[model samples]
Target: MRGFISLLLLTLGLCLQATGMAADKSVIAVIVTNDNPNKSISLGELKLIYWRKKTYWANGQRIHPINLPPDHPLRLQFSNSILGSTPSAQNDYWNGLYFHGISPPHVLYSDEAAIRYVQETAGSIAYADACKLDNRVKPLLWLLPNGETTTNPSFVNCN
Candidate 1:
């Protein structure tokens, strides 16, 4: 009976621990095409690119910013991390832009979709879990929660 009770308590504790861990967001790397000439971008510049303010890269290529569906948790985390805003903030911004007949970035359904889109499209950028990175996309910046950065030696050539 004592062993059964101990096992039950241990299982409950692990379940609670997993729940808390799920709430903690991790670092995301902004990925672009592997052959993109622009090696790096500042956080402010990246934010503007997403906002559609910085519409083109240095090579005169239109920058296509890709995003996951607004309801996705990682999408919320990306919006909060990069823009200091929520998904509703984006909806409001886009609604305001629509008055002028302007549109927003392409919304992909998953990180894999974003990766595929960026690879096929020139001057595209998107954020994804660092662990999901592949050779097709070159990470330009590694962003942590609360606006911090780390240079990813293997992923980004931003030295």
Candidate 2:
């Protein structure tokens, strides 16, 4: 009986740890500088911006899109949502566009870095784990892992 209890406790602990890790991927914030005029963005516009199809904001400032590393969970979620494809698959598209002077979003090392980049660069945008957000940037959209906006804004209480 003692051995069985110990095993159950160990399993529970591991399961909890795994769930905590996955929680970070549950919600993401599409962030931009507070000074950016746009209060909200649409899914189609996000797709165009990330794809480099939309080179400038409506205000005429050039758009600068930031990205996290290819395998990062936040980035994978953003790419799948905004680009409608996986990071690896998008590489092929970027390669073809390379000859035309188009480049993929600049890659940063972490959500913090991406946020910092967006804050410092006007007309810039990036996605980060919503829970990690700070006041330095504004969130244009709060998205689920599947790329859909959260139905209830109150449910996403980002700091």
Candidate 3:
């Protein structure tokens, strides 16, 4: 009976640990084409690019920033973290920019589509759930929940 109780408690502890770990997987993987010359981008520069205030890469390639739909969880997290606003606030920002002939980033439906778009389009950038990332494109930044950024994927703690 003591052994059974120990096993039950152990299982419960592990389940709770797993739930905590899921929260860590929320780190956003900011990806770019494999051929992109940039290996790292600061959060501020990323915001500029996404906002269309910075129009070109260091090599003079035009920057193409992509976004997920407004309702996507990753999008919400990204907007709050990198863009420094809620998704709705971002829409309003864009709405005003529309009259100035400035458009928001193109929206992709899924992480896979974003990955593929980044892979196929030069000078493009997008974010995906770190765990959902494969090798199609290289991750240039890791946006952590703690408001910090990392260029190293090993530091992302995806598991």
Candidate 4:
């Protein structure tokens, strides 16, 4: 309760000591399971993961890619920023992949669920808002729609 209250006050920028704490620090990022040995994540690799082009981790563990629910803003951002199109535009591709037994990434309902899943599962990765990030999961990379990429970001909450 105390933690939630503090977050609420900080979100409103109304706490006496929360004056400069900005949500601007938040971003869309790729999060991978802790056991992953990859030192850096790239946009190209993320695209391959979503396209089901990349299937295994370095240690031969199957990589489980996760998709965000359609209603989530990060879903659209991910679609455009990473997939280069909206979900509808890629419907045919998804269908073709399905026909060939190449399924799309599994969908998780929320950022929290994605984070928890990644934390508990090996070789799993998902895209989510960095604000919800913490020590429980490691963010592989942070990408802006403008083509900027951040590796191992220092999120305010994680600090």
Tell me the spans in candidate 1 whose CA falls farther than 4 Å from its real position. 1-22, 153-159
User: Which 10-residue window of candidate 4 scores lowest in summed lDDT?
Assistant: 17-26
Clashing pairs in 2: none
Put down candidate 4 lDDT per residue, 104-124, tens digits, no spaces: 889999999999999999899
How do the residues 123-147 of candidate 2 rate in per-residue lDDT, one tens digit apiece?
8999888888889999888887655
Model 1 residue 102 lDDT? 72
- Winner on lDDT (1 vs 4): 1
Candidate 4 Cα outliers beyond 4 Å, as residue runs: 1-26, 145-147, 152-159
For model 4 the local lDDT of residue 146 reads: 56
| Residue lDDT tens for model 3, 25-95 | 38889999999998899888999998899999999999999999987778877987888897788777889
TM-score of each: 0.80, 0.81, 0.81, 0.77
Q: lDDT (CA) for every model shown?
A: 0.83, 0.85, 0.88, 0.79
lDDT of 1: 0.83
Whole-model lDDT, candidate 4?
Answer: 0.79
